[model samples]
Target: MTETITFNDLGLSEGVLAGLRAVGYETPSPIQAATIPLLLEGRDVVGLAQTGTGKTAAFALPVLSNLDPYETKRPQALVLAPTRELAIQVCEAFEKYAAQLPNIRVLPIYGGSAYGPQLTALKRGVHIVVGTPGRIMDHLDKGTLDLSELRFLVLDEADEMLSMGFAEDIETILATTPEEKQVALFSATMPRQIKALTGQYLRNPKEVQVKSKTATAANITQRYLMVSYPQKLDALTRILEVENFEAMIVFARTKSETDTLAEKLRARGYAAAAINGDIAQNQREKTVNQLKDGSLDILVATDVAARGLDVERISHVVNYDLPTDVESYVHRIGRTGRAGRSGDAISFVTPRERWLLKAIEKHTRSTPAEMQLPSVDEVNATRLNRFDEGITNVLAEKEKISFFRDVVAHYVSENDVPELEVAAALAAMLHGEEPLLLEPEPVRPQRQSRDRDDRNSERGERSNRAGAARTNDRGDGQPMASYKIQVGKRHKVEPRMIVGALANEGGLRRADFGNISIRPDFSVVELPADLPQEVFDALAQTRISGKLIELAPDRGAPNRRTGERFQDRPARKPRRKD
Candidate 1:
């Protein structure tokens, strides 16, 4: 029989070991067990593991063991993540694992943050630089970040970077790093592009694959609830009331939605905060730390903003809006079920999103079991039970409750009032003006049959939801109008870049987009006919892949679109970069 290998058996340094022990890491996960040794032995490694499977510690531990904390004059290691949140997460993990080494400093640099602090950190001499590829590339371009002394380069979530349109940036950054540096790349899946990257960049790397049943970890209990769009907030509030979750993240689709939902949750008495791309970097970090330290219990966030957000206290993840793709679903739910803890991934599926559910099931090869929405009676029962339990808990602490009990008894004796009446008055005072019970949902009339006109409208709605908006290609005669943008394949543009820009700036639902096709020097996308002038103007000014959309209706002639705002404007010479 073979014995299990622990983190102690992995030949880590005294400082790293002390730090791990402090963080309560008693054993190594499968990926860590396999990859840490190779990293410590000065070998490049390619690791395959899903999110939330301890991949950070796998490479971070070994890197910490090898680096000299006193050598903080320049960065000895660089960790690249696909998103700001992920970069922050990796940086935090490194800081936690290097707790015993006080001299070691790690700085996370990403877009949406001011350059002053990052520049100060760089000038102060950081030991480790964790940042997204775009920000790293910008620093490299500005001649601020030098990689000549870097000893280790870890590409965490390499596949996600490529999928998010960082292929060129990754290559450019890799070109700047010292050739003598050891590379450690981690990704959930190895597509052809990632394989090509490994072949070109890594030198005889040791590959380790941790097999799993699905893209998401098995520890996550995946479920879906059927609800209408208007009722989603109500359903989520009810779930929060009944669910025994310690901490949770509720994912919304847009920045506005995140803020609105967080505000609503706070109003409902949940300690909540909001995070999205539009938020400042400091505020985002503060919110995440609040969630970690138990000061906050709920974080409402957008998908991009919550990428790689890992908090051990998070026991549940609620998908308030469905992700655009299956991979996003996996990534969003992956925030929970981390380490060895169990978690719940609950998604709300509107009737029109049934196709998305099917796509998820087909991709994961596991169906999300349907979850029943908590009924009014169930919520009322839970409330009453909690009320009773609160009293019971207070009574158990006799020393604390004796004063209140005496005051109540004295009031009853002074007024010669019934004990029950005084108790009811006290309960009313405690409960305040909030209703003690929730009203049941109103029933809707069922449609027994459909006329031709009703059927046509239904078909149109289905087409909008199920067509190119979800599939990335327009169907023939889909009743959608086409618009053109100046950025395309030549500009290294991606379909999602267009979707995200329009959705965020124009506030258009994902279903509003029709067909999206990328061409050589330009790209075209389908949108609803006769869009409001304000929405068109907003989209025309939106930027994608660092280029102003300069959008124009794909009128048979190649005239200007720019939402008619730039129709008379002279065609300014195209920028070199764009």
Candidate 2:
């Protein structure tokens, strides 16, 4: 039997392995599997795949593996994404994968934010930096950012960057980097501009192309919802409130799931029914007739039972469970947009199944617009409008509601209450214990403050599943504070880099020259009095070779860096001779 390839088989650092487990990814995507080994072997790579492919992880993982953060704290790996959103996204991915390796630091730099923090983060020493081309250029021009020590460079979405007219900026940035560094360029299409770019910058690159057969449905409007399996019902219920779908077919994977989902939908008063392989032909036909006659609003069914089932009233198709193969997905959504009518297809994908989604998109040649789960407040507003419309619609039927009006008027008089009060009371009774407005969605604890450049408040709604959980962002309003760590070192690290991490963490000027000593096992240096606690914690947790550092107190120190009394480092000279 052929050996099954997995992430475990890939030569990854333990931290990367822990990250894969945390993010719930079991197998590598085609792009990742093909590109990882080559990049890890110090070969430049060219990846050709659509957006949803696992491109980010493919390069990010290997770069993280090869980095020696403690030995050299400056930005070693730089990734240039096309936009602020993608930069933030790629930065967050780096942070997540480097979670187990607390010593490594990552930052996102872009144009809109103030430059103070970006310069500060750079000074403090970062292992990886993800940013847009424009901002990176600004830093390079200002001499605030240095790429002299850069070991790896990645041009993510190279085609998009060029389309956005970052072609010149990309070339300038590429020219600044050392020629010895490994470079990777990923793009969906290779145009002449991109071809010329690869030829000029990339050195004998190994092309890793992942192509899928084209499948198109021009008439169908496709969208995808990123929700967990348990949260699907909540999402479906809220979607039903906002959608004006006349009839929908919800596809599930198995017979039991179809039956259970149908029962749940009916319990919510959706006029829903189920059809599966086990159902009798007579009952199936009856259900189909009811759907066609408008008695059924939704039909939940297994793929096997849904075959050859067509109804003109069907306006929507929902993939309750994603199909295992591309053909299956195409066939499921194909149920709608039939004949001469246009239709909608919504697929529910769990966060971890993003790779599968990308694969489906690449095969179908249709980019499904990402969807946000409706907010409780938004749903409540929708309900209120619907309720008001219901009453206004009823009130329009003057002849039909006269008896109900008389009953309500008599109740108001009997209870000695105003007509409005009577109406409110009646609405309360009709809704029973269920509140007309749903409680708001639970808020997660805030980690990093939103950056000034944040276009959206939350992550997922604006992101493509691979998004910002806690941005490695420092707010402008935050005092330009410094952070550092103290630990007993068990492994070898460059002494200058350690001091650089300390000096930058505390925002200490180059003149803060206190004598520093370097020892074999541990090192001691004077810390800035104004160093931030966050930086202190980070320094304390930072591990070199998976071992913690020993914190050394100043002047009348207990233990000292035994190597020698280090000389004061000079200040950096001002910029842009090139």
| Top TM-score hit | 1
Top-lDDT candidate index: 1
Looking at model 1, which ten-residue stretch has the lowest summed lDDT?
A: 569-578
Clashes of each: 2, 16
Model 2 agreement with the true structure over 33-102: per-residue lDDT tens digits: 9999999899999999876567888999999989996855568999998655568768877887877775
Deviation of model 1 at 177, angstroms: 1.3
Model 1 ranges with Cα > 4 A deviation: 213-221, 224-236, 240-432, 435-486, 492-513, 517-578
Inter-residue clash pairs, candidate 1:
551-562, 552-561
The runs of at least 3 residues in candidate 2 whose Cα sits more than 4 Å from the true structure, single-residue gaps closed, are 212-363, 367-578
TM-score of each: 0.57, 0.48
Alpha carbon lDDT at 472, candidate 2: 21
